[model samples]
Target chain A: MSSTLLRTVPALRGALRASGAPKAAGAMASTSFVRGKATLPDLPYDYGALEPHISGKIMELHHAKHHQTYVNGLNSALQTIGEAESKGDFTKAATVAPLLNFHGGGHINHSLFWENLAPASGEGGGEPDGALKKAIDSDFGSFDTFRAQMNTALAGIQGSGWAWLVKDKAAGTLGLVTRANQDPVSGPYVPLLGIDAWEHAYYLQYENRKAEYFDAIWNVVNWKTVAGRFEKT
Target chain B: MVNIGSLWQYLALHSTLSGDSTNTNNTANNLAKMGLAAYTLPALPYAYDALEPHISAQIMELHHARHHQAYVTNLNKALESHVAAVAAGDVAAQIALQQVVKFNGGGHINHSLFWKNLAPAGSEDASVAQAKGLVAEIEKTWGSFDGFKTAFSAALMGIQGSGWGWLVKEAGNGAGLRIVTTKDQDPVVGGDVPVFGVDMWEHAYYLQYLNGKAAYVENIWNVINWRTAEERFAGRSEEKTEL
Candidate 1:
């Protein structure tokens, strides 16, 4: 990947030189030169912390292997984009955009997923307490209804995807949204909670019973973290 | 990947090809006629189980008869509504339908290519050996056929979720071949011509390969229709030279 990016540098530089866009050149030089790599964020708790609800094996594999892969992919893509921009090859940059989005989204979603989970001990699982509780009642009627709705949506995902509890910032209303794959929820909405419906997320423990996995996950729900996100949004 | 703009152009082209303009009521009549033509699922060139061992008959049947059919149905529905939106100058409605058009249109386009892209393993005909131009181009771009395969396979394996990996002839003047991936049902667009595509969606492999995506990716090479890819590459070269 690095070699590929290096090869395109001269071509990008040539294109930039031909275009004579001084501002773009300056921007590229400044931005790409100092860009940082995306590193995997450490889990707030140990691998076995969410056990009974989520297994130690699942958390270890999901965080160490899966999330790590995304972090590496995102970094490589960003490096390629930075290299392309530095050389002034917008085409190379454009070609890598899909990778950037996919890996970038994977990183974002997983990071959020970790924070939205807890050990289901004293700190985890139950119900939201203040503004979040009020909002849930207003939007989805009651806590039971919201759980049913989220579970139904999560179970019905045709393939790998996620079920999100999002705050539609523009409308100032809470809504349930489903995104296929690692696609991050788009702007005008902020994801307060996300339920990963991918087979890998539950295939180990639940086998084919996705509904059981969905039901189990609620026990580990970090309502405080959810409420924090809700409060900010 | 299918371009939505060219899809509209294709509707117009279909109308002209069919010679259905005898009822010249207005431009709306032309659009309605084109919309009526709509997109249809293409029949698979071989038996569903033809590419066995590499790809199972069951997988092909569902991927083609069901999944591909759904895309065609949805595309037709979206286009039918789009005709009225276009005639009424309802920009908002037209804009709203853009994603529907892209997703379904792309599914139609990608699967259509995918079906033709595969054949029975070891089924290469005389024409495959004669595809000197495409072979040379691939060599030039990736150093060798093996190198190209390695790169393409890596790209496919890296897909985070449902998507496709493609070997495309990049768009614009002085374009060259490159390996790229598109998330979800996004069609190869922006001037690129997809010479070959491999579906990385789990539905394409889950029943047979299970979670072993690397196995599926590697085995798909056995059934790849190099002749079809060569033809596409040659056709694109001709277009570029003519331009």
Candidate 2:
């Protein structure tokens, strides 16, 4: 039975490859060269840097344990796919697509999340000044309004998920969207700013008071990084 | 008007005096009072810790009380509002409620099925003998019972994020049995009848198993109520034959 199942996988993958179906946005970009491994990225600042807003203990676990787990899972999934591809067993690749999406999304989202924060000093929080600022004001009326809207939306997430400030490339508009679980905001929209609403992200700091956590997160928002993303978009 | 009022009073008195054992009168009254039937969370067929060792008591308690109850509550709210929308002929409002309906409805359906599909390990009856027909069908489809289990576990392990793995009986097309997976509380659709389902959501196993999903999947088999699967399979197959 195993052999019979394996036999058809390669043919299926070959057909998919031949059709050249457009991959979803933010798929494993370096699948060809990187093969199966994903390494966890370093944080831009110390774990305690966010202080008051986000604690060092939370940061340490969120990054070292939670983020590392995703990195490991993604790598394992990629390895399985690579082996199947090598053996012309594309069926295995097809089966592991969810792992790629889940862990891959986890890895991708966490990577962006780390860069999305900064220490209270220097570049963290305050306000956006340039094009990003104009976009926020133009799209959402004002910075305060945008903050209020994002906070409300983040607070309303029903489960482990994220709330994003995404720029629609085509429309050149900023929109607020919340995703359930580790699902990434799909491509064609550039993520300018995102708040991880997963319990692990804020539970340690704010407990059940999600609103308080949402309020605190803005203090550590890396406006500089967000503006850079906005410029590129 | 005098005659009609007298007749109505007499019928009401008779109904009250009879104490209608069928409760039809009460049902009619309630139906008239409430426009739609409200869905409620079903009580677990077994004790919270009945399937112990295999599934922790704490997991079952939270899963049933917290998770399942939330789904039932949200589903009722969604359906209640949807009733108003449907009555108003509000197409946009009805369309907007589709996700809420599917998510909550599916959660209700799937969890209800999940609870029934498990039993205390070793406590299952020798009724596998009575379910010979379904057993034969399973053997025919997967070469043997073990083969079917292997395929089912493989499918279960492959669920990317939160989802369920099902052993479904597909009617017609040879009355085949298929192993299928649905993402994020999606109930089995099409003409397939799910004989058994195992939730692969992290919340389902994270507390007990932590990240060891493989162990959870393996241990779950020990407590699966095969009798329930057999009954479901038998009923579905009979339906197909009749069709």
Candidate 3:
């Protein structure tokens, strides 16, 4: 009984404290009220790690400058929405939706894209094995076929966008999906691997020869990470 | 039975509601300012195949028909919703709709001008002599026509993303020429007159030029409508670009 009382005392005290607190204070103090700011994730490898295939210069600018802008934009949009909603300015909150969608999707896509790449010398490239290979073969006929299809999708994108290898949730089958601009992969599809086709992705090294960049990217694809995501999904 | 005082009060109220104090006597202009007027896609001055060889027929068709048409359709839709939102005092919807209006509206305005700014590769209007007044101004500003071309081409090449490079005449009396660039579909705003602009968006040259932007830039001068440039420079163009 004494041990039980000891455990119950803290719970009782917490309940009393919560009840006695002012409504605003209680809302503020809730753990759920804390908002996490989106941040630029640290690159897993050195900027120059994917060298020859993708230059160190491009990696530095893309990761440090481009990705950071998205992170900042996402945070700003979130903060604006929160403040607008607090003040009952629903219009202002709604106004921020596009920015939030754009910057938020950019942050999410870049984070996933960074993790999807690895140095060619290490655990990067090569064909997937185990269940991943089976699924790819079953869905796309062969590994080469799957690659060609992804590359074709990448080439078909008219403007800034990404071509993703996605798995339909209900169907559990692999598919190729393309998104315009920074639109995130959502609604029943799980993005397994994404290749950014924005001009900024390869303009410095490849310029107008985007097909070469597409072919070269396959050499540095981190299939291990893709396999992990596939199995988890 | 209305008194003179009441008549004045009603007119004042009407003007305030119409949101056109400056154009109270003009009903059409008032309707336009109040977002009641819808934007339409301006037809290309020349045929789709007119600017071929330099800019392909395929590119011109796609750029004008599909892309510019989408902007016009979306802009009209956004403006209609904005009008309703304003009437209903839905500030959130109005704010949310601002960027779409700006982007699509600018696209319409820019493309409308771009069509008029181009002539056939060897047409009379394409000759530099048609813009003798503007040519002299360009010479004064950048030393020579080649000097100006070199400078403008550099600006176009320097753009990192989709944008436009323009030759604008400064606002006010005795305005001077300036080279400027705007990102995406942003139009030349404020007091300056955009004499001419070059679309640096990848879609503008990607299909034909295919990463050879320098070649496209060098070739564009052959089709430039110097006549239109002269009209815009002299501030006497009949092109109704008031968006």
Candidates in order have lDDT scores of 0.80, 0.77, 0.82
Per-residue lDDT of B64-120 in model 2, one digit per residue for the tens?
987787777677666655654554555688788888888888898899888877888
Cα shift from native, residue A96, model 3 (Å) = 32
lDDT of 1 by residue, B121-240 (tens): 878732356457777998999999889889999999877777899988887887799999997788888888888799987678766765567899989988888888887876743422
Error of 2 at B226 (Å): 2.3
Clashing pairs in 3: A91-B92
State the weakest 10-residue window (summed lDDT) of model 2 chain A: A24-33
Chain A TM value for model 2: 0.83
Question: Whose DockQ is greatest here?
Answer: 1
Model 1's CAPRI class?
incorrect
How do the predictions measure up, each by TM-score? 0.60, 0.69, 0.52
Q: Compute the DockQ of candidate 2.
A: 0.09
**Model 3 chain A worst lDDT window (10 residues):** A26-35
lDDT of 3 at B200: 85
Give the C-alpha lDDT of model 2: 0.77
Candidate 3 residue-wise lDDT, A32-139, digit = tens: 234496666677777999988998978887888778888888889999999999999999999889888888998999999989999999977899999999999999
True contacts kept of each: 0.21, 0.03, 0.00
Q: Could you say which candidate leads in lDDT? A: 3
Give one digit per residue, the lDDT tens place, for model 2 in A100-170.
Answer: 88898899899898888999885788998999899899999999999999998996665568899999999
